[model samples]
Target: MELLNDMALFVEVVKAKGFRGASEATGVPNSTLSRRISALEKAIGLRLLHRTTRKVELTEAGQIYFERCKRIVDEARLAHEQLGEMLAQPSGVLRVSLPVDFAVIYMAPLIAEFAERYPGIGFDFDLTPRHVDLVSEPYDIAIRMGEPESSHLIARPLASLVPRLYAAPRYLERSGEPKEPADLEQHECLNILKANTWTLHKASASIQVSTSSRFTINSVGLIRRLATLGMGIMLVPEAIVMDDLAAGRLLRVLDHWHGKPTPVYALTETRLLPAKTQRFIEFLKERLG
Candidate 1:
């Protein structure tokens, strides 16, 4: 037998007082258990038990060895229980990263619902505009916009946030409604400063148009703010403008032209996911739909 197994058996036999009792406790046969204990004594060069009677008594060495072996057995039992508990419920902190704009508008409801469902799991969220490193960073999950390039990390599509041209209702009254994508040239356009180009999709064919706007902003929230103020028409995700639309603050312009869906991704370290991550992703996907 392995040394650890022998040590464990020795401890059990000493505690139970004899091979017969230890065999019954550990389910090891009496003869094999006796031989194993003898082999352990020979290896250790110590008399562990004084036997050949109704019961057995521990030697000095047996008492010392039993103390150490009990600790090892206790540790093994604890490790087994910990693994089983991990399989049953989500535990520990689940750190996540997301864009500030997306988190505020779309993810807020999803997170509230998620927290209610998995009350045992804790969350740590970092909301920022810049991209975060998944491999080096401490976060377990990331919500990213636009198409993800090929990488080892797993990316699950939560939603395709299709953009539509929009402006404030008050702005439309001042600047007049845009009839087509080209009509945007006449209105003040709030541009998100990525590259200069914007793609406008029609019923049949899509057009890649280069735009020049007076208000060029890096922050999506700032751009939305500019549109809400009636400065210009902007192409933004419906999630961001849904409240404004419902409140009669923002109005959709050029209903015929829609921007292509900017894919939203729930990225993680691996596709073979744990229960907590899998459940959160599924929840977000369902909520988005």
Candidate 2:
């Protein structure tokens, strides 16, 4: 048990790249963390890390040992969490990174329900556009739209949101309604940055409609607001504009045609997840899938 504890400490030191950082992350004293790692090296009869004043680098033996120990520690932690779930409700601070617009517009109600279901759990939600570093950061998971760019992270698909063309009624009244996919070329479209084309699909046919806009947006919330304010037409998921549709702020265009389905994923650093994160992902899949 002591050996396992030491190995876990070693893994944290390597991940954090220094004793001070590992101490901050694990809430262990720097002296204690250093002592533990030294004891671990002595026990294993190998020097795992080359320590310097500025930082620590893993020795060849340390790198190999870290790879093996990380998996073992993760598995052990997972086993404990699984057992804890069988005995009681999974309880902990679940830190999650979410897309800003989706969390407010779509996931709010679902999150409320989840909170009610798991009274033992607390949450720290980070809603931002930045792609968080799941490997180095302490975030438990990140919910992202579209496919994750990094292949190193594990991505679990939660849902696919179908996008369709929509515009404020006032904008449609002035610009006139588009008759077909090609007609979109004539209208002012509100688009995300670098988005030049929108492909619309019917039962058997599809066409890529070239789009141009006066305003370029990077934020989904801002884009939705602009569409509601009658700036221009937008290709977005219905869930994003549900309130606008309900209030007659926005109306669907090209009723027969739809854009490509956008995928939502829960990104994590590893496949082995704690119960708190695992259950949260499962709940999302149940409601959103």
Write candidate 1's Cα lDDT for 134-161 as tens digits: 8899888998999997988889998888
Residue 102, candidate 2: Cα error in Å is 1.7
* Candidates in order: C-alpha RMSD to true structure: 7.0, 15.4
- Per-residue lDDT of 1-289 in model 2, one digit per residue for the tens? 9898998999999999999999999999999998999888888899999999999999999889999999999999999998876755668899999999899989999999999999888999999989999988889999999866867899999999999989999999998999989999999888889799998999999999899988878877888898898888999999898889999999999999998999999999999888789889999999998
Q: Against the true structure, whose lDDT is highest?
A: 2
lDDT for model 1 comes to 0.84
Q: TM-score for each prediction?
A: 0.70, 0.69
> In model 2, where do residues sit more than 4 Å from their true spots?
1-88
Candidate 1: where is the Cα deviation over 4 Å? Answer: 1-82
Quantify all predictions' global Cα lDDT against the true fold.
0.84, 0.91
Assess candidate 2 and give its TM-score to the true structure: 0.69
